[model samples]
Target chain A: MTTPTPRANSGPSGTSDAPAVPAVPGPLAALPDADPAARERLHARLVDGAERAGLLDVAYRTLETPVGPLLLAATEEGLVRIAYGVQDHDAVLADLAERVSPRVLRGPARLEQTVRQLDEYFAGRRTRFELPLDLRLSTGFRREVITRLPDIGYGRTESYARMAAAAGSPRAVRAVGTACATNPLPLVLPCHRVVRSDGSAGGYAGGAEAKRTLLTLEAA
Target chain B: MALRPFEEIVTEYGPMVLRVCRAVVGPHDAEDAWSETFLAALRAYPELPEDARIEAWLVTIAHRKAIDVVRADSRRPLAVAEVPEPAVGGSGTGGPGAPAASANGQAQQPPWERDEELWDALKALPRRQRAAVAYHYLAGLPYREIAAVTGVSTDAARRAASDGITSLRRSLPGRTEQRTDAGARQRRAHQREERGERP
Candidate 1:
């Protein structure tokens, strides 16, 4: 606070020399806080500009569902990353930043259909994920294994050994687990359909319970 | 730590950048400067080090964008020659040429738009002084930071902001009017009209 002890007067009309003139807050002291509508308008413009310039490398959002909040991300091409709550959404996003372009955003316009289909699937009304997908996050044998996930069909379960054999390497069953464990597009790519050879739910990146939830939903 | 999603960055610094842009380029071109600044930033944001001072980095980009706006303004055809009559300000008064004045003056004009006297005084300051004032006062950067951002010496940046404030006080109108209850209420209303915050 200003002490209100005016600087000693060196000039006449000492009435003007007293407490408040210099102590008063100046008009320059602050600016009006940013208008929310204006901020939103500007943000929308920024998003559009970034997209136009091909700088929106990734756009994503979180969807609340029976499984948990899924972090769905898309590139300019298609849906690229999906993360379950246990994957530590923040950590998953950070990994995406490291592997994919760091120019990621939470703008979900790119994921509208993805979100809608997911909602329907969770509601047991739809069983297929016929969405454009980006596979840049997976490569080699892991990629090959996940690429065959959708071929298993809805409401059908395949054992890891059988899924591995279908991926053309029967003995690579554990590798199939690794591939599914790292499946970037888990639910959409149908990784939950893979089960243990003994008919038990296998470990899932979304945790075993989430996998059961998906399988049960499919059965329903 | 992994960089946060870019939306958070935009949410955090967008307003400060807008204010800096307005102080340097005027309200007419401030939004454009802000847009360009953010777009450019989003392009280069991936490589930005997390430890860097985000505010200083944003202000730096805003400074460059402000320059671009000023340059673009100077190149406008209307700027080439003064007509016999300049258009009057505020809404419904001018044609398409005055988009900024009319388009942004909807229900209530931004406080910066209403504070025409402050705008004039700020505009009259030398470009460096204006920038220094904005970076220091509005953005709350230190003199050293102003120097780093504007590429001037610490002493010079300090002098520019200090001198800018000195001149601003002398030339500014309506600063000493907060004593009246009506004046206080009016100022608060203008603030609330444009924003929910004083910062």
Candidate 2:
């Protein structure tokens, strides 16, 4: 295949009286093609610099799951948010920029360890997520409820009343439901393990279907 | 109005900056210049005006980075034997008629590799002319922006680019005809494919 030169009208040679040289291809077309590996390396380097300079406010990556794509985001503090594809990925990112900081980037390398744990968890090989939790998105009673969720364990289910009691307010069962409904980091925190007192799956941020899928995945 | 994520900026202008870097500093030092330019851009991105022309901003940053690499090269004596391979992956030693792929993945003969005369001619131009040509022709910057970046008047920037192109054409006679023919052939093939003629 022959490379197409830039249009003669667009280049510096356009108005020259000299014999029309073939419009030199712009450096973009003329330069050697970029290697995928080299591009990845450059991205990694940029992320490293941004992290060092404290310019990276939020870094996120999307993971394809049996359920759907999951958006996982983190700050320098730790993994901060996880959302299902149904949550409207772009809207989630916008909210993250507002609530956290506007300096966000899609840097997958930053979530390497988190992704590994998630992979193992989805495969049912890991019973727990050992990564640092950033719970800044939840606060007060909601924060208290989610903070107690990890104790619900890998395959076990707990009632909303039981979660409320564990959070030190048994009467706040409805609040516990609200907390579970808004859990910022779902699977990692195991919030889906909370069920209704009647043993029915309660409301879930990832939708009732996703909650059931997680429960089934765990039960198996 | 919020600033776009620096990631988008990188995606949109990364290749353009890479090309500018390669043209200004040669392929060997281009990657370093490209990396440094982006790193610097990221650091200052939050404060950049929303209306700022991002392409010009990136090109300006690349210009500074290329100068840094050149200055450092001059200070540290040339180590011809130890010079690292071109960091972006190609050998930068592809011979005339060597097969190279375009960004779109088509197997095309690289004109730059085939016509070393053009590169030599570019290098022979004055520094201001070389930069003007690269920014205006390669980066597609306006004469005003090129003038601002190169610290020359707009008229001077235009003249530099024009002179640079004239010199290249004079030095590399007959090369244009080959490229134009190749370009015409490619356009025909493209039209054929668009019309569902290519199998």
Top candidate by lDDT: 1
* Candidate 2 CAPRI grade: incorrect
Off by over 4 Å in 1: A3-25, B1-4, B47-52, B75-106, B171-199
TM-score of predicted chain A against the true chain A, for each candidate: 0.85, 0.80
In terms of TM-score, the best-performing candidate is 1
Candidate 1 lDDT, A92-198, residue by residue in tens: 87788878877887676789999999999888888788899999999999999999998988999999999889988999999999999999999989989999999
- Predicted candidate 2 versus true structure: per-residue lDDT over B48-82, tens digit per residue: 88898887899899989999987876786666313
**Candidate 2's TM-score:** 0.75
Clashing pairs in 2: none
Stretches of candidate 2 exceeding 4 Å from the true structure: A1-29, A32-37, A51-57, A160-178, B79-115, B173-199
